[model samples]
Target: MIQRPLYINKLLGFKDKQLIKIVTGIRRCGKSTLFEMYQEELLKKGVFKQQIQSINLEDPLYRDLINWEKLYDYINAHLVDDKMNYVFIDEIQNVADFQKAADGLFIKKNVDLYLTGSNSNIQSGQWATLLSGRYVQIHVFPLSFKEYSSALSSDNKFEKFKQYLENSSFPYVLNLNNDKKQIYDYLGGIYSTVVLKDVIANKKIRDINRLESVIKFMTDNIGNISSIKKISDTMVSEGLKILPVTIENYINALCDSYILYKANRYDVKGKRLLKTLDKYYLVDIGLRYYLLGNTKTDKGRILENIIYLELLRRGYNVYVGKNGDKEIDFIAESIDGTEYYQVAETVRDPLTLKRELSSLDLVRDHNPKFLLTQDFEPNTSHNGIKQINIIDWLLE
Candidate 1:
């Protein structure tokens, strides 16, 4: 079990706190592993084995806990009087009225609770209303480039790193030998489960076929601007009767499932986020390769997707830079008011380099405006902007 310091730090902060520790993300994205790490911490800290109870509601062994009362009874029976108790629940959403169970455990003076789910629709109003201001929600994503490199302990680091970029940062794929077919098959399984279980099973949807089509379209157009009107038009051309509102609803369902990511357009010239169209990025890149064969078409956009996820992992509020007529791949600003970045595939050609640099020039602010590329060369500085190799930046 490799330690994820980022998540560990968040978990450690909640030690013995009254607030419920909630970790959410797409399925198989290391939520359960983090819980295991936390359990180890408790044991090392001299927490009695009996004081800690971790239950996976998804397991068939817990079938009797189909409702809140059964769950409450099981947890209440384990509670020790006048002693601090640690409770960890995995896939808590599987239990009906999960909020009630969570609330019951939370109100007990001796219990410190932790819960995790693949989606946020676990308990609608009660979790927020009852536990309001008492719980902290931490989002966990797949491995970052730094985490990915650490996972691959190979002598040939660059080769392994390249494979990580191509394959993905999914935790399960780390054990599977770098076979392209097997990696994608694993990604497809995760995708299907998220779609069927999280989206279709939980949400109100009239047509599963149309929902799947919309998801395919979103995946194919990762990093490109999209609109409901455009989607409706495309479906009409394909002879599929899909309404614009229906397309919008399906998109919402996909987002709810944590399968698709949507980025709103920020007009740099206007200095605000625009409402017309938005770009979409998948939670993992390997899934795109699986669903839409290995095509060299749109490698630039795909590279953009990779950089986008990396920026997010680094704790930056990322957006597309729109400087008058020029467009920057990314405009990342950290919350601490420290860092900023602008990514592009390559700036080898003078005209292309100028186009990339031009976007940074418009933002006269003195923060870092880096131009990331695939080219291997010395990091260059032009007009107060720095240009470096994207791979090298990821390593740093």
Candidate 2:
């Protein structure tokens, strides 16, 4: 089994803390697997099996325990006499008024609560109001480049990276053995489920066609600036009458489901955030390829998408930086410092390299600036900007 230390270590650090550990991410992104690893970790630490209560609400056996009161009663029944219990509830969103049950369980001195879900609703709005500051969300992303590379046939970094980009960071695809049709079919199901069950059904969106149109446009235009007005205009030009407000709601549903992430624009010169334009990157690259069916055209934007997720993994609050006339692909701000990045497929060509670095040159900050590309060259750094090979960066 692949030991995903990044997530495992996080769960270990927060074990038995007062705040509930909530794992949120795209469907099948290994949230449940993380729970399994944590359970094993507990056993290895000499915790008795009886003290761990794992409830998968989606299972037919637990179908009757859909209400918060019943689910709480079921968990309470599993509690062993006078032992510290670790309660793991997978797909907690399956339970109606799940927050009530979680709040009840959280107050138990003997219980440590852990929950996983494929939707962001657990982290926002009505749920947010109920939980307040009592929860810590550990976002579970698909496998990282390093995790993906560890399963490769050989230790060739380039080959592993090429495969990572092609096969994607999704965990299940690692077992598909590069079967294009099978991979597409698997990801297509995940996409449809997120759209149909999570977004459309949950949001009660009537216009499925318009929602899909918005998705297609957003998927095709990854890393590009997007606005409701612009999306509505583009769809209308294509003979689809999707209103700007409707587009906003659809994007919210997609983003709330963890299928897409929106990065708002920040005006660096003004030191203020711009709410008008934003860019949405998918939770996984494979999903984009599966839904859009063409990865040939926008290689740079796809690279940007990968970098966007990577920055997120590295614990940075990423945003699109607009500096006067130029734009930085990502302005990642962490507690320690801020870093600006420009992503490109290759900066080998002189003109292309110039264009890629031009934005970084505009930034006045002394913090590190980077230009990430796939092609490797000895003279990678120029004019205070460091050009790192994308694969090497991913591995690092």
Candidate 3:
């Protein structure tokens, strides 16, 4: 197993905090594997197996335990000893009123709680109203390029990079052979399930055709400024009658389901955030391509999407920086400092390099600014900003 140090480190830090350890992410992104890894760590530390009540709510064996009363009854019975008992519940949303049960579980000082879910409905709605700030949401993303390469165990870094970009960061892809059709089929199934179970069914959406048309438009227009009105108008042009309000709700539903992420624009000069014209990036590029076949022309935008997810994984508050009229690909900030980034397919053309660096140059701040590309040139650092190869940046 390729141990995900980042998530494990987080789990270690939040081991016995008062808050519930709520893990949220897209299905099959290794959240369950993360749970298993954490469990192994606990056991190795002398925590006995009997003390941990690991339950999969989706499992057929737990079909009878579909409500708070039954789940609470089983867990309450497991709280036998005075020692701190750890509870791990996978897909907790399968049980109705799960938040009540989870909240009730952590009330006892002898019990520590953890829950995983594929839908944001677990964090919002009833859960949010009940648990409120009593929980810490740790979003589990797909494998990063570095982690993917570790699973691949390939001698060639470039080959690993290419495979990651084309297939996706999902951990299961690591086990499959080098077959594009297999990768597509697996990702396609994941995409369909997330859309059907999480987005459409959970959100109670009735218009399937309109929702899919909007999905196609968003998938095609990755990294570009888009709004509900823009999506609605474009869909209308394609003979799909979708209202702007419907588009907004459906887009938000997809985002809540973890299929897409929206990065709002922040104005550097004005020192304020913009409400409109945010860019939506798919959770995984392979899933995006599986839904709407890959195109050679959109490779640059696809690279931008990859870098966005990486920044998110690194725990940065990332925003699309708006410098006057120019657009910076990403403005990432953390407690340590801030970093400005511009992503491009390559800087082979002088004009392209100039365009990529223009926004970063205009910013007067002394913070580190970087231009990431696929160029293999030795120009690692520019006048003030750093010009880095995308692959090198990902690995670093």
Candidate 4:
């Protein structure tokens, strides 16, 4: 196992907290593996195997325990009272009224609860409304470049990183051989499962054609600003009659599925989110490449997408930095409201470097501002703004 320390660190903090450990992510993005990793940690810390009630809800053996009452009975019968009982439920969203079971379990002080789900529609009633502030949601993503490299052979690290950019960050794809067809098939399966779990199961979206069209349109216009109206218009132009409201619902479903992320354009000078346009970034680039059948077009924008996800993984509130009229690729702020970053693919041209650096200078705040690019230059202070390579910045 690659041992994702970044996530494990968060899990360690989740130990014995009164709040439920809710891990959410796209399907097949290693939620089950993360559960296993956390389980091992608990055992290493002297937790008895008998006290840990680990259940894979998707397994057919648990078919009889589909409802909350049956699940409660099943878990209650297996409860060991000698120590703090740890409950691990994978894909808990599959069970109806799971919140009742979860909230009911938390009433017992000796139980530590951890639940995993592939979607946000996690039984909306009492568990969420009643246990509002009592739960911590941990969002997990596909493998980062760092994690992907760790799983590959040493000799092919760089080549594998490039392959990762082309294929995806999904862990299973990395374990398999780097065959293009195999990667596409694997990612396709992931996409299918996410659509089924988050879209079909949670949201009763019957128009598969319209939803798939919206996905294609969004993927094709990765870095471009788009709206539901624009998507609806484009579909009509292509001889498809879909309502703007339907398009909005489909896009919302995709967002809930964690397949596409929307970057609402923020006006840094005005300090507000713009209403008209927003950019969409696919959860993984490999899926984009698999759909497009090319990884070379608009490489800069693709690199920008990579930077966006990395900033998110690094616990930053990222936005497209708008400096008056100029557009800075990113304006990343840490969770504590400290630190900021500006990412760009290259500053090869003098004008490009000057333009990129100028955006950072526009922000009068004396916080950490950096311009990340592909150029092999060390930190160059341009009018008090630091310029660094994207690779070095990411590794940092």
Candidate 5:
């Protein structure tokens, strides 16, 4: 497995803490493998194997332990006294009333609990009410560009990046050796499982065709500002009778499944979040290519999608900035304060560079600003804003 130090460090940081650590992401995004890697680290640190109880609820061996009482009793029965027991449960949502089991385990001073789920619902509803502030969530995404590059033997980053976008970023794809057919097949299985099991069945939607249509439409338009009415109208014109309300629910389901992420608009001048014209980005660009194929190759938007996910991975609450009539591609806000970003395919043309920088110029603040592009050039500063090569920025 390719070591994901970013997430592993996070897990280590919270080791032995009182709170429950919940790792969530789209299915097949390496949540299971992450647990294995972290377990190895624990053993290296001299944590006894006997004190660790790792259970994958998806396995048939645990089929009989689906109820909260039985699951809690089974784990509690195996706990070693006078030692810190590290407990990991993969896909905890599979167990009925799993939050009660988690609450029970949390009360035991000797147990340190960790969980993995494929859906966002694990963090909400009854789980939130029961655990309250007693748990911390660590969301896992597919491999980033830096992680992807580290797995390849090639030194040419530009070519590897192109292959990364086309082939897929899910960790297992690296083992396929750049075969397009096999990669597509692997991505297809992931897509089907995520859609059929996580989305359709979990959301209890009867219209698989309409759900897929919404997915295809959203996947095709990743970086564009979109609304429910706009999607409903487009699909209607395309011969699908999807209502705005139903479309809204479908979009919400997709976001809940981690297949799509919604970035709400932030009014930079007004200093408030707006309710309309939100932008959606996919969890993996490879899934975009798998669903829509190579025909809709809008390089600029694709680059924006890549940057959006990177900002998210870097621990930023990303938003689309609305500065009066001008638009900033991203307003990445974190504990370190807000940063502005604008993405383009290339800014070699003087007119194009000026047009891209104009939006950042409108924001009269001292916060850090950046212009990211595909142009291979030495890093330069535009007044206070910085211009960087996207690939170099990703590696950094």
Candidate 6:
């Protein structure tokens, strides 16, 4: 099994804490695997096998314990007297009023509770209200480029990255050995589960065709600024009469399901967020190849999508920055301060290089600036801004 030290280290840090550890992400992004790995680590640290009680609600063996009361009683009955019990409940949302059971389990001084969910609702509404100030969420994402590269025997990172983009990054696809047909079928299964079970059924959305149209438009325009009215207008012109309100609902559902992520625009001069023309990025780029065939793609935008997700993995609040008329590709803010980024496929030409650097010039701030590209020359510095290869940056 591939080791995810990034997430595993996080779980280790929160081990045996009073807070309920909730791991969340899109479906098939390896939440279950992460739990299994962390459980193994617990055993390594002398956590006894008998003290660890794992119940996967999705498993048919636990079907009878679907109700919140029954689930609570079942786990409560298995508690090891006077010893710390590591209770892992997978897909806790399968039970109605699961927070009741979670709360019951949490109050026990000996129970170290861990839960996993595939949708955002696990932390919203009733769950959030009941578990307020009592939980710490550890969000899991699909394998990063570094993690993906670790699983391969070859040292050819550039080739592996190309394969990572074309083939799906949903973890299981790596086991298929880069077969096109197998990857297609695997990604299709994930798409259906996330759209049908997570988005449609969970949100009670009825129009599958219209929902798909919106998905296609958003997927095709990754890294581009868009709005509900613009999406509605475009679909109407294409003969699908979707209202802007319906489109907004669909977008919300998509985001809630973790199939898409929205990055709002930030006004650099005003130092505030803008409410218009927000950009959407897919959780996985291979899904884009699966939805739209492997035709010609915009390399620049694809690189931007990769960098955007990487910034998120590094724990930064990323946004598109508008400085007067020029738009900076990303403005990542964290406790350290604000950092600026500009991503492009290549800046080999002087004119292209100058155009990319101009936006950073407008920032007029002491915060670090970066220009990431695929062109691999010696890492150079234009003024104070650093220019590094995108692949090198990912490995870092």
Name the lDDT of candidate 5: 0.91
TM-score of 4: 0.94
Write the residue-wise lDDT of candidate 3 on 1-396 in tens digits: 778999999988998888898898899999888999999999999998888888988799988888899999988987757688889999988888787788788888888899888766664455567688898878889998889888865788898888887887889987778689899889888888988989888889998888888888898888999988888788888888887888889988888888899999999999899998999898888877787776655578989999999999999989999999999999999998999999999888999888988899999989999999898887567788998888888888
**What do the candidate models score in CA lDDT, each in turn?**
0.79, 0.86, 0.87, 0.79, 0.91, 0.90
Error of 2 at 38 (Å): 1.2
Clashes of 1: 0
Among these predicted structures, which one has the highest lDDT? 5
Q: TM-scores for all candidates?
A: 0.92, 0.95, 0.96, 0.94, 0.98, 0.97
| Candidate 3 residue-wise lDDT at 102 | 81
TM-score of the candidate numbered 5?
0.98
lDDT of 2 at 194: 80
Candidate 4 residue 16 Cα shift, in angstroms, is 0.6
Candidate 5 local lDDT, 227-295, one digit each (tens): 888999999899999989999988888888889999999999899999999999999988988898887
Question: How does candidate 6 score on lDDT?
Answer: 0.90
Q: Which one wins by TM-score: 1 or 2?
A: 2
Candidate 1 matches the true fold with a TM-score of: 0.92
Candidate 6 root-mean-square deviation in Å: 1.2
Distance from true location, Cα of 155 in model 6, Å: 0.9
- lDDT, residue 117, candidate 6: 77
The list of candidate 5 runs beyond 4 A from truth reads 123-126
List, residue by residue over 1-396, the lDDT tens digit for candidate 2.
Answer: 567888899999998789888888888889888899899999999899999999888889889888999999989998987988999999988887889899999999999999887655654465567678999889988988888888777878988777777766788888899898999888888888888888988889998888988898998888888888899899989999987778888898888888889898999999999978899998887877777676466789888998999899888999999999999999999999999999999877899988888899988879999999888775367888998888889888
Better of 1 and 3 by lDDT: 3
**Model 4 Cα lDDT, one tens digit per residue, 62-171:** 88887998998889889987678999898787788787898788888888999887655653233467468778878888888888877776765446657777778888
Those runs of model 1 whose alpha carbons end farther than 4 Å from true positions after fitting are 123-130
Candidate 6 regions off by >4 Å? 123-126
